[model samples]
Target: MEEEVNNELPLPDIEVNSDVPRGPFALLNRYGNKLKRLSSKGGENSSKSQLLSAMTIMNMAEKVLSQSIHEKRGDVSNLVEAFGSDYADYLKRVVWLLDASEKLTKRQYDEAEELLVLALSGSLEGHPIETVLTFYGKYLQEKIEVERGRIDLERKVEHVDIEQAVMDLKVGVVECEQKLPYSQISNFTGVQTILDSVAAAERIHFIDFGPKFGSYWILVMDALARQGVKQLKISAVFSATDSVEETGNLLTSFAESMNLPFVFKILHLDTWEFKKDHLQLEAGETVAVFMKFCLMPLSDQPNGIGALLRGIKDLNPLILIVIDVEADINALDFAHRFKEALLLTCALFDSLEACLGRGNHYRKIVEKVHFQEVICNGILSEDGGFKRCFKIDLWRKYFAEFGLVEMELSQPSMHQARLMVKGSPSWSCCTLKMNGKSMIIGWNGIPIQFVSAWKFHYPVSPAIDLFILH
Candidate 1:
C-alpha cells in the first residue's frame, strides 16, 4: 500500500533556474520544485508538503488570472480550465480571492463583496488552504463594508464584549498550549528567567502588564512556593476593559492553595498611563515586569509603545520579560500588510494542522476565535488592535531606545523548551533556536514566537549599589 501511494505521487525532478522571470509558468514551476523537495523528506502526507502544494496551486491560479486581466482579456475560463478537474474547486476559490483582492485594491467595493461571498459559500473544510481562504474572504468583506460606509469600523469594534472576548481568547490559548509547544516555550522561559533573576531575594514583586489569562503567573507562584520564597506579591495591570477582577481572584485562589504568602494588586489603566508610583512599590522587594502579547495593540497608537516602555523604565524593575508572536505586519500599505498577514496565517494554520487532528474541537476554537480575530484586527482594524506583531529585531530596538538591554536567556530555559518539544510526537517539527539574547520557537523553519528578557542599563555610579542590593 505504501509503495503504491508513493508511486502515485512521485516526486518531481525539475531543474529550477535562478534567473527565470516571475511569470505564471516560472512561479508555478518554482513552487512545484519546492513541493517536490518538501515531500521527498516528509512524504506526500506531511503538513508542510500539503500546504506548499495548496499555495502553489493558488499562486498559479492567481498569476494566470492577474496576467489575463493586465492584458485586457475578458475571459479567464480557458486559463483556469487548463489545470483540469482535479483542482477545479480549489482553483475556483483561489481565483475568487484573487479577484476580490484586485477589486479591493481598485476600490470596487460591490464587486469585491460579491467575489468574497462567492468564495466563502463553498466548503473547503479539510483543505490545507481552508483557513487562509476563509480569513482572507472575511477580511475582504469587512473591508468592503467599511469602504461602503455600511459599517463604522471603530464603532463596530467597540461594541464587542471585551470581557467575554478575553475569556474566549484565554480558553483558546490554553487549548493551543496543550497541543503545541510555542506557548509552553514562552511561559517556561519566562518563569525560568524570573526565578533566576530573584533567586536570592526574600520578597518578590511581580508586575504583569497584561494578565489577560494570568496562567503564566500560576506557574511562577507554584515555582516560588517550591523555592521556599517568603512572600510573593503579584500586581496585575490591565487595560480598563480586561477582566481584571476575575483573573486576580483566580490567581489569589491558586496562590492560597499553594500556601504562598501572596498579595494581589490590580492596576486598571491605559498602557500610556503606566507609572512607577501606580504600582505602590515597597522597599526590599525584587521587581519584575511581564509583558506577554500585550504591546502589539499599542503599535498603532502615536508613540504609545515608546511611552509605555519609558514608563516601565522609570519603574526600573530588576528584570522584564517579553513574549510575543514574531511577524512583520506593521506596514502602512494595505497590500503589503495583506501579504504579510497571509503568509503568517498560512504558517500558523500549517503548524496547527501538523499538531492536531482535522476535527479537533480545541483546534477549531483556536482557529476561529483566536486566529480569526488576529487576522481581522491585524489587517482591517485602523488601530492595529491585538495583531500588530513585529519581529524580535524591531522589539530589540524598541527596548534599547528605552534604556533596556537584552539579558541572555539562561541555558535551563533553552533546555526546558527542548524538553517540551521532544516530549510530544505532534511537535516533532517545532524548532527552537537562540537569536542573539532571545529564544525563538519556529514552525518548519519559520519563526512563530520569541521569548526575551531585558533589564535597565544602569550607569557605573549606581550599578554597584544596585548589584549589591539584589
Candidate 2:
C-alpha cells in the first residue's frame, strides 16, 4: 500500500496565551491615570510601562496559583512609599511582587502566586492589591467553574474586567439588533407612519442628505412601495464623509429590487456644503430631505438653517422632510427655532414631530464610537457652546413661514429608541396640539404638538413666481 501524503498546512504560532492574556479585560492606558494620582513625580515612568507591569503580574497570578516570588507576599518593608501610608505601602508590595515575577524564577513565581491569592482571599489586609488582583481572581474562579460541567470536552469561557465585559456585551447586542436582515421583517412597518402623513401631498420625493450605508433609505423606499407609491422620483444627496460608492450602489440595488420608480443619486458634498451650492430649481418634486443623525456635526456651523432652507427652495420640492435629534429638555427649545428658520423658505411648509425625549439621546449614542469628539470638540463654536436646541426651532419656524402646514401623524417614530442607532433619524420632537392656531406652549408634561414632518407645496409656476410671490 502506498503511504498517504499529509497535505494539511501548519497553523501559525499564537503568541498571546494564558497567564493573564491581553484581551478586553486586560490593563489599559486608563490605569496610568490612576497611577498618576499616587505619585508626585510620576512623569519619570511612562504610563504604558506601568499598565503593562500591572497587567502582566495580575495575569500570571491568575493562571498559576501555586507560583511564588522571591519577595515576600504583600511585603513592602524596603520599598519607597506612594500616595498615603496605606495606599502607597500596598501598591509598593504589589509592584515588588510583580517585579519579582518578571525574572520569574521558581520561588519568585510561587511567591507572586501566594501574594495574589492572599490579596483576593482578604488575608493580606490593608493592601490595595485587592483592587488590582480582583479581575484575575474572578476570571480564575469562572474558568474553574466552567470546566467542571464539561469534563469530556474542553470548553473556554471568555472573561474580561466586569465593566469592559459589560460594555462589550451591550455593544454586541445593539449591533446585532441593528444588523438584522431586511427580509426577516417587513420594511413597511418602519416608514408607515411617515408615509401616512405625507400621503395627501401633491408630489413626494425622498431626499436623504447623509445616507450612510443607505440601509435606512432602502427601508423607507420599500415601505413607500408597499404604500402604493409607484411614480416617485427620489433625489438623495449623501455627505461625502461616508463610503459614497457603497451607499449609491446599495440605494440603486434596493430601488431595482423593489421595481420602484425612483431616481436615487448620492451627493458628493457635506450636507452643510450642499446648502452652499447653487442648485437648479425644479418644479413639483416634493423634496423631503431626510437628515437624521447628521446635523449634530454641523450644529455650530454658521448659517446651517439658512443653508437647509436655500437647498429646499432650489429643489422647489412640494414638501421638505426635516428630521434630526431633538436634544433638549424643552421641546419648544427645538421646535420654536426650527419652525422660525424653515418659515423663511419660499417653498411649501408642513412639519411633524416624533420620538421626542429629554436628554440628548443622539449624542449619547454616538459617543460610544469616539464620534463624540467630533461634535463636542470639532463642531463647538469658539465660545465652546451654541444653541443646539435652536435647530429644532428653525425647522418649526420655516414650516410656518411657508404655505404648507403640519400634517399630524397618528404613529410617529420612537425618539429614544432611534437614538440607539449611530446613524441619522436619531432625534426627538415635542408633541403639541395641531389645531389651526399655532400656539407655542412653555408646556407641562402632556405631549401636545409632536409633529416631525415638514410638508409644503412649491407651485409649478416658474422661479419668477416664487420671487414675485415673496
Candidate 3:
C-alpha cells in the first residue's frame, strides 16, 4: 500500500497548491509549515510548535480512525500504522510534554501536574528534554505539596537533618564556584577592590556576611599574602541555622599555611541583625565588608536589607563588596514571576548543559541544590523565599538611599573577567559587560550575575582614623 505522505520534500518546499483538495494530507502539509516557522524562533516558541504539531498529528490520527470505522474495515489496527508502534508511543509522550509545557506557561498547576506525571511514567533517560521535564515535574509536584500542607513536614525533616543539608549546600556552592564564571568574577573583582582600597594598611579586618564556603576569603588571603600583609582577621557572619565551625576551621587552616597572622571569628546572626557593636572594630585595623549571594533573601523581611545596609554604613568599612544574581523576581505577581523565573532558569540550565556532560556528578549536584532552590523559591514561595533576586539597578538605588556610593572596579579585574570567559571553550556563550560601575556576567545576552563595590559617602571623624589612609 502506497502512503500519501511526501517525505522527500522539505517543509518549506511543500507548496500549498490551490487546485489540490482540502484533504487531511493538504492540511498536514500546511500545519507542518507552521511548525517550521514556530520552531525557528526557539525557546518557548519551540515548545508552542511542539504543542501545535502534536495536536495536529493526533487530529489526523483521529480522522483516519474515524474513516476506518465508517468503512467497516475489519480489525482496524493503529491510526498511525504507517509509522509503526514505536513512533505512535513517542508521539503520545511528546504530546503529554507539550501539553504540560503549555499548562505550566498558563499557570495551570493541576493540569500540568497530571500531564507531567503521564509523560514521566515512560523512560526518558539520557535526554536533555528529560532533564527539563523532570525539573518542571518536580517543581509542579512541590507546588501541589505546598498547597496541601505536605511540604511543611518535609521542611521539619530538613531542619532535623540541617547539618547534612548545609553540607550538601556547601558542596553544591563549591561546585558552582569552581565550574561557573560568576563567582570567580565576583571574587576576583572584590579582592582587587579590597587590595586597592587598603594598599597601605598593615592589618586588615575583613567582615563577610553570608559567607559561601569561604572561597572569597581564600582569594583575599592569597592576595594579601602576596602583598606581604602583617596581620589579617576574618569575621565570618552566618545565620543562626548555618553551620559555621567547618568554614571557620577551613579559613584558619588556609591562613596558617600562608603564614599570615589571621584571627577567625564566627558571628551567628541574620544579615539584618548585624550591628557595629557585633563587629567589635579595633584601632589600627582596616575594616572591609563582603556580601556575596546573600542580600537578596533579606527582601523577605520588611526593611531587612535597609537595616543591614545602615548597620554596615555605621561600621565605616573602607569598602563594601556585593556579589548578587541579576534578577527581578522580587515584588512581582505570581504569573510574571513564573515567566521571569522560567526564562532565567532555562538560560542557566542551558549554560550548564553546554559546559558539562549530561551525566556529570557536579552538574547533577548543581541542578539539584542550587538551580532547583532558586526556581522553587523564586516562583513557588508565597512570601518571597530566599531567592528574591533583584537587578543591579534596583540594588544601586537601594545603596544610594543608604548613603553608599558606587565605586569603579579596577582594570585588572575587568581584564581577568574577559580572559576567564575567553579562555574556556564551553563558556563561549557567556559574556561580560559593565553596567555603570558594576560588572555584569551574562549568558546568551541575559544578565545572570553582577559584582559591585560601594563605600559610605561620609568619611569617619579624624579622632577615629587610626588605620592607615588609602
User: What does candidate 3 score on TM?
Assistant: 0.70
Candidate 1 on 319-391: residue-level lDDT in tens?
9999888887776556567766766676677667776656655666667654665577556765434347688
Candidate no. 1 TM-score = 0.76
Residues 353-428 of candidate 2: C-alpha lDDT, one tens digit per residue: 1111112233123222322222222111123243343334544544454444554322222211121111212111
What lDDT score goes with residue 257 in model 2? 86
Model 2 deviation from native, Cα RMSD in Å: 25.2
Clash count, candidate 3:
0
150 in model 1: Cα distance from truth in Å?
A: 4.4
Q: Which of 1 and 3 is the better model by lDDT? A: 1
lDDT of model 2 at position 338: 22
lDDT of 3 by residue, 1-470 (tens): 11122112111222433232232112122223332332232222112111222223333434454455444323234444554664454444434544454466566767867776776777644444455556655665666566656777346322122234447566654644455656655676677667767878888999888636465576677767766888998888886434567767877899889898889888888778888898777888898988887766666664677677778888778999899889877644564565456556655766665555454556666666556666666546664343477888877766665677999776545554554554455565666777888887776566788889998986432221101110
**Candidates 2 and 3: which is better by TM-score?**
3
Greater-TM-score candidate between 1 and 3: 1
How many angstroms is residue 22 displaced in model 2 relative to the true structure, after the best TM-score fit?
A: 54
Ranking by lDDT: 1, 3, 2
CA lDDT, candidate 1, residue 97: 74
Give lDDT per model, in order.
Answer: 0.66, 0.35, 0.61
Considering summed lDDT, which 10 consecutive residues are worst modelled in model 3? 461-470
